[model samples]
Target: MGEKFPEIQGGGSLILAWQVRNKKVLVIGGGEVAAGRILNLLNADAKVVLISPRDGLNSEVAHRIERKQVEYYDRKFEPSDLDDPAITMVLTAIDEPDASTQIWKLCKEKRIAANIADVPPECDFYFGSVHRDGPLQIMVSTNGNGPKMANIVRRRIAANLPPNIGDAIAKVGALRRKLRVVAPGTEEGPKRMQWMSKVCLKWSLEDLCEMEEQDMDELLQSYAPDQIPSLSQVRLGEEPGTWQFDGSFGWACVV
Candidate 1:
């Protein structure tokens, strides 16, 4: 019914490179492409270092670096450009294979992660165009094969998410905490999630402002699991029908 995509790599690749909340990330080369990557890293709260050989740097980027929000180096690439011991990763967009190769070798010797633009084989990681929200980020990547397609997919997904999604998520968080308190011992996690799903489904169909308290209470109460008769007890006096248990971590069902 829907198109399937390849499994994503680096899902939990310890995205935090050092103390990323306030740490250093060095971006070599300057252009619109480098600007985009640096922006995303900055959003993750990484302190950025951008070095450009010439004057092609974006004005906004230069301004931020000048203001000390980011650091900029206006010089040609040198062997020492890769000598930032504090740098966690180096993203090179110099548009040259020999330079990228040399840089990769240097990074390897230094034990630093490096990404070469448009060169997956030489890159330790590939940059993905991403859109982020609080505690949630959507990354679209084509594994270094057509970032244009990735951008298209990202925009398509972005369109489906509206501005109110954040507020709705906050509301859900509040409801989840309330549920944990209200239904502590009576429900399992899966069942609780299902109950929340049903509530959201119903809420989607009605005007929340007009929702009645009695109706909401009735819906919540209905989510409580009804006690079922124990199978072992049912055949106590009979042949004691073969009670086979499918162990489910304290949730066994006798069949």
Candidate 2:
């Protein structure tokens, strides 16, 4: 038998309490490894800049840089590379460990957070495989030690996601204002969350609309600030349907 695989590793317990949209992220690499990290940053809408001298790299990467999808510098990184005011984080996968270490040191001295692909001790952060649905982003990590495993888990989880998830999120977001209007008190927060979760689990537009109307009716009896809403103890009801989605994400139910 082999070593039992860990359920998590490296930076698994980490959670992003803040959003990273439109932030600047720098990468110093030009190979397939760098491509994976770069693609994730792009998906997160970060302003990504890649520094590498390699020409005729992956065709799509070359095309994207040329099209200004990302900025590319056909040169090696320098000590002064940490100059971008907008750059809050950096990731490096350069072949030279010493060079990566030095770059990480420079980033730290300049107060920019950095992560090195294979140097976990030097990394202030770790990369993870991510799947997103509208405003919901799921990131899987085995720290930096097992990105492949993380990716495998990510794909499994993604396969279970219904195609309508994004649309369902959009519909739910549209209903929030109506929810707030009906449940006009701090006491309704938990009940409202429960209701939203119910609507999301069903993933039905008609059911969500009906839930919205029901919420409106429930809130018709406006309560004062100290008044306890009837739904204060309300629990999300039973799921209405069995999803046709894959079962690999069974673990996510507990999550």
Can you tell me which runs of candidate 1 are displaced by over 4 Å? 1-19, 170-255
Per model, how many backbone clashes are there?
0, 1
Give RMSD (Å) of candidate 1 vs. truth: 11.8
In model 1, where is the ten-residue run with the lowest total lDDT?
Answer: 246-255
Predicted candidate 1 versus true structure: per-residue lDDT over 108-166, tens digit per residue = 99998888888888887777767676644777778777889989999999888755554
Please give each candidate's TM-score: 0.61, 0.67
Q: Rate the local accuracy (lDDT) of all candidates.
A: 0.64, 0.67
Give the per-residue lDDT of model 2 (tens digit) for 100-131.
88898888889898888888899887777888
Query: At residue 212, what lDDT does model 2 achieve?
Result: 48
TM-score of 1: 0.61
Error of 2 at 230 (Å): 19
User: What would you estimate as the lDDT of candidate 2?
Assistant: 0.67
- Give residue 17's lDDT in candidate 1 (0 to 100): 26
